[model samples]
Target: MFRRFALAGFAAALLFLSTTPVVAAGLDAASINDAAAPPTRLPDRQQLSPSIARLEILLDRAHFSPGEIDGKFGENAQKALAAFAEANGLSFDKAVTADLWTRLVAASEGAAVVTYTIVDADVKGPFLNKVPVKMESMKDLPALNYTSPREALAEKFHMSEALLQALNPGQKFDKPGDSIAVANVLDTEKPAPVARIEVDKTRQTLRTFDAAGKLIAFYPATVGSTEKPTPSGTLKVTAINKNPTYHYNPKYKFKGVKSKRPFTIKPGPNNPVGVVWINLSGEGYGIHGTGNPGKISKAESHGCVRLTNWDALRVAAGVAKGTPVAFVESSR
Candidate 1:
């Protein structure tokens, strides 16, 4: 029997908005949208700055995904800015120059952050109380759903859950019709067709190109680890599965999974492979999403190319069977 769970005890019936207006915090929508690029470059250490958060949203809208919008100038955000700079033929290092900032702001759409009203679909979820940490224990669950409405909304806006809460302090995510500030990072139109894909193990990033060799999209990725390295050379895409059942093979001996026997995990947002799977021609290797978006390029993967769930979905939508995917040792 499948156990259904309500998200954060939210009522099935959608609630009307209260008369109270949502107060803006230090990292509020107004601040984010009104923020300007710092005259100097971002600090080397990760810090919560409204400007960085705004920059991240703009990068996300432009398809140079900065893993998750966590209001920090981390390595993932750095990589994304670097990729964006390179695509625009601008010189960049660990810092964002004035020219780069101007180009990014010009390329992006309206505001970086906008007010979004919560809806019934956003709150009404048969969510999971908790996802198991071990792979063996996950097979028995009916489905891997989002743990809370906050998580769903965060992923939907391409923002981190922490950022979501930080932006809306003291507000419970359980009510529909309640206003919340979210990243204006919606990509309504379908992506252009991808001609080729490049997975850089050294850089821990993925890039897609058009038929004319124009860079289409760039994403920070967690490639294979030392335990099981990803394949080299070019490979063709075999298949793309939007909702994939994760079949665990015993031979690979993935650490922390004590099960010697084969098993299959049900598909949902919190599944081992997340929501999408782009299978590669190389045996036992593929590009897929991850349950943990925050640990994207910061963590290690078994042997597959791991992208954020949204990034994986974007890639899956743009690519087709026989799309050339090349794995490189280094971009240098």
Candidate 2:
């Protein structure tokens, strides 16, 4: 399930490690293409762009997740289609056609878009005005909640907030009495337990595969920066924590911190680690969720890899304590 929005965000870049250079100079502008999922050579979307989005949603529901389902037949969708085709005993490089359409429709259970009621709970509660950039400054907040109700709802339905807003221009997302339409794509299929996770720092993407080396899930990520580069070797997932409180040690000397002492950031979906923290064996490194889904693969992190909260949860849920997590420079 997607995360719900709430107030009380404790901004954190994790306790820093200045042995490396200070690397969190967030970029000013980011493009959609900045978020590259693993690409495939397979032919895509013979139809219109919306048709491509629908096909992506179908692929997602049928257990092959294509990153964010943004309705673009970009790299991620092509990869997902190729994976699905190969799994179903069809040629992986074939173009989109009637045969593929028949298979997808048969595998899919519902429409790609459906009407959803925005309940009071989904829009309820105190919301955070904004998440703080420095964890050291937060002394009173209880938890790191979502920055807005729109974010909470978007996570609930697995769509970007901007895309959700575009789908319903006049609806008030923050209020209780709004019925809206949203992407019906949900990753409910239990994937084969993930055998390994590859973190491509160059491409800023994470790919998960089963024992047979079939790609099952893909996500755009913001890996470590130049100053705080992620470990350049293989690691393993040490632990998984839901609603993990972030403890920031002041010794690392992260940028913009006036405090000289350590602090603890409360746990919530908007926390630096977002909803779930998949801890890696590498020292102070792992894959976790992020507050800004849009900036994923575009922004730089202190040293950890970051994905959207929902995507992280989807991948984390399927992994185990000993799952291999490899950090490598982009192969593509």
Candidate 3:
């Protein structure tokens, strides 16, 4: 009976494999030698240019959530892809290959695209406007930070890196600053609410809530590691400092920094924390920026909620000193 069951399972597997459609066209040695051979178009119905806008949408649909889908794929996109791949049992190669595309399509099948229209009330000012606009290509944006080459284009446009990958579906972004067009626009008025963070040591996630207690953002975060765990208690924001200078004291070396190291670093993105610093009520512990935004939710920190510079900035602007910050093991 066991042998029969095994045979049946093998047969089913073979049938499934056989039913899987083969999409790649045959390319012979002659085709490889023929310089006149036309380029192979991607499987998608539309011909998407290698722009950041397209990449941003793709990454967004894949549930990587590259923050804002600005266009230029960057460090955030790469981080999102790595996390997505890990969760999906795929290799974190950063390259969006045919296999990755298939998985993304499967993952984004039920995903919803919320539309937003620009309103007079939504427009902050000349410098900041929540306008309903569209772009032909993500290449129109300026250069992006290239920590992860796979998602460099997305970063350049100040867009969400994960969304770019999802929009492109099966296409790979090997080159830096690749351009792509984004067809969708913010056609309605549905603004995303402010982010409220709830640190949970047990689940290892920073749950973001809105004014109504509705969970809007959820990010995996590296609280204090096992050896130097994060302090368990409630804390509140004391102050928000932008472009903060890090006073690196050797005595407080969580990562074994020698005493001879520099005492302080100038305010810049490369500082110990990235660009923003939110001082918590705790003397030494606080939610601050990180030099390595990609490792925000992955690696352990000294004893703080380390967020990406952009993420930290958003959180800082959304909350105040009196805003309640709860540090709990779990929601329950």
Candidate 4:
């Protein structure tokens, strides 16, 4: 139960925003790290707020991912915050209360943003000039690398490409030895082993549990669409494939794919299955990563559950071959 691919349409928009000083000037590390509790009502969708960005980074650090940290208090961010609040016994009524903020900050380690020195690896690319929009065209490419250094660094730190540019105005990501402020979300330590996983279709979320049934991690996810609904009941992990090559089955008859023949897509971050694919017992169904990190939870998948590349990697690292994966149809 996986989509052949979902084209992320935000690249051009992010590239355009990178050049706009006004947009990038609106926030910085100081603003983000020192951000106060947000107002009762969230910021407008169009408005980028440092407070929300801080909130997102904190939530991410706490193992409750907000998907892409775009500095916007959108549904994904709200969902993460609400989940965090519920876990901490704080009542969230669509507001960032002082109690919730205090709890989040206390639970999270390190500042929301920190200085990162760009290394040669960060700037060096075998970078793709452009990724193909169509899945069929993508199969021929050598590798599905990030389109730019900004994209690479942004993904590494679990921040949006636009947010990375916004934090370091006028700083081109092309050079090594340059320093920039980025989200302090590098998970250096290994995650706790997961005994079980729950995919809440209604909530568009994935939650992992420890052997003692304690929540280990939570992530916003893109569930299946009406066209290809996710499987019900429970499944078990069959395998964990890192940097997996995407194999397409013509039998799926995925929309927009004209080829009646099966094909294979090369492995990379932007591959259809992304950095990691946690195979499930159900055929073609597993929780995996997405090329379009920004569109996660906001868009629908073909059938399989989709999380951010980083989150997927973390989840893959945490779960064993036989971990139980339950797909809950509703909140109950």
Can you give the TM-score per candidate against the true fold? 0.91, 0.74, 0.49, 0.92
**For this target, which candidate reaches the highest TM-score against the unseen true structure?**
4
TM-score of 1: 0.91
**How many angstroms is residue 174 displaced in model 4 relative to the true structure, after the best TM-score fit?**
0.8
CA lDDT, every model vs. true structure: 0.84, 0.67, 0.48, 0.84
Query: The CA-based lDDT of model 2 is what?
Result: 0.67
Q: Count the backbone clashes (under 3 Å) in each candidate.
A: 0, 2, 40, 3
lDDT tens digits, residue span 230-330, model 1: 99999999999988999999998998888989999999999989999999999889999988999998889989999989999999999999999999987
Stretches > 4 Å off in candidate 2: 1-49, 62-66, 72-107, 174-177
Tens-place lDDT per residue, model 3, 188-211, is 223245445688876555655678
What is the per-residue lDDT of model 2 for residues 112-185, given as tens digits with 9 covering 90 to 100? 66666677888775678888876665545887777677878887776665455545545568767666766676
**What is residue 272's positional error in candidate 3, in angstroms?**
1.7
The residue-by-residue lDDT of candidate 4 on 159-203, one tens digit each, is 887788767767788889777788888776789999999999998
After superposing candidate 4 on the true structure, give the runs of residues whose Cα lies further than 4 Å from its correct spot: 1-26
Query: Which one wins by lDDT: 2 or 4?
Result: 4
The model with the greater TM-score, 1 or 2, is 1
TM-score attained by model 4: 0.92
Candidate 1, residue 213: lDDT: 97
How accurate locally is residue 163 in candidate 2, as Cα lDDT from 0 to 100?
51
